[model samples]
Target: MGKAIELNQVDTIYEGEKIPSLKNITLHVDKGEFIAVIGPNGAGKTTLLETIMGLLESKRGEVKVLGKQLNGNGSNIRKLVGYVPQEYSIDDLTPFLVSDVVLMGRYGKIGLLKPITKNDKTVAKKMMEYLGISELSNRPIGKLSGGQAQKVMIARSLAKEPEIILMDEPFSNLDFEARREVSEKLTHLHKTKNMTFVIVIHDIASIPKVCNRVIVMDSGKIVADGKKEDILKPELLEMGYKGIAC
Candidate 1:
């Protein structure tokens, strides 16, 4: 399979910081691969996702997605890659309803000036239903609970009909039952849609069963990358958690 994402000796540094948040990172994700990126806090897991989505430009080296360079074509590339960021600050009085927020995801594909078509609404509705949030379509987004809001974000990402999905701590706000339900839905989507996924999750137990590969990061670098079975070995995990790269 072709690579869906590639980072070659990449170094991403935030402004005003001397040290790069991501250091000498080299990785490749094959199309349709379901991957779990696990690491401790400050391990650069979030940075990796943002860098791949081209939200943060690499200070050195090359970053490519779907065979295109990220430097010159980030906006176009991002439209095909759905991203659910870790946090969003929505004012309680923002006045946007859940349905409106979800439909906003399609604005990139449908064009900002074009009217929303029947097909766009259908896609957005289906995504909300699949995510078990159809009942919240008319609810004000800022009034929803944390878990409810998270589901809306997930639905919005799915509504984009993206070829790849990058999610950061997607289940963090969910309760046990909601987490299980969402995990099952994601697994089904991965199997049926052949969409590539790169999920950064802190809880190893919550990693989806459909995830075939595991990436371990520490100190802004990839310490290990391999099959889930190999990477999840007790000894290996212990080392990885302790900041020792394999």
Candidate 2:
């Protein structure tokens, strides 16, 4: 299997910060792998995703996506990556509808100045239908509830038909039933579309059943990476949480 993502000795430090947010991170993700990155707060999970997506520049070492370096080709590379951030704020009066927001995902492929094609609208509507949010198409994005907004974001990302999807706390706003529903949808997509996913999550129980790998991070470093069955064990997880080398 080809590598979908690679990070070699990567260190990312925020401006004016004394320490790196990510330290000496060396990792590889194979194409079509569903991975769950689990850790407590400040574990650098989000930093790793941003670095992989080329949103944050690394102070040292190399980051690659789809066998290409993320340095100079970030714009082109990002079009193939779909990212759902942990938090997105929307004003109540924001005029864009859910369908419009979802269609925005095609902007990279459609070109910023061009009109939206029929195919683009079809893809957007299909994504909404797949996500079970078709009824929300005409609703104002700003007026949706938190879970609804999150579903819209998921639909938007899916509309891009991206090769890789990176989600940070995607189910944070969802209730138990909704989270399960979304999880099943993601699993189905992973199986049918062969899309790679790296999800940052706080709750281990919420990790999707389709996730085959788990990465544990602490104090800005990856302490363990292995099969889901091995890494999700209580003893191993406790060790990771306690900062013991796994």
For each candidate, give its TM-score against the true structure.
0.93, 0.93
lDDT of 1 by residue, 1-246 (tens): 899998999999998999999999999999999999998899999999999988898999999899889756478778889999997988898799999999988986766788999999999999999999999999999999999999999999999998899999999999878888999888888889989999998877777878899999999999999998888878546656422111
Provide the lowest-lDDT 10-residue window in model 1: 237-246
Against the unseen true structure, what C-alpha lDDT does each candidate score? 0.89, 0.90
lDDT of 1 at 129: 93
Predicted candidate 2 versus true structure: per-residue lDDT over 1-246, tens digit per residue: 899999999999998999999999999999999999998899999999999988899999999899989856477668889988897999999999999999998886566788999999999999999989999999999999999999999988888899899999999999878888889888888999899999998877778888899999999999999998888788546755422111
- Indicate the TM-score of model 2: 0.93
Model 1, runs deviating above 4 Å: 71-73, 235-246
Instruction: Output the worst ten-in-a-row residue range by lDDT, candidate 2.
Output: 237-246
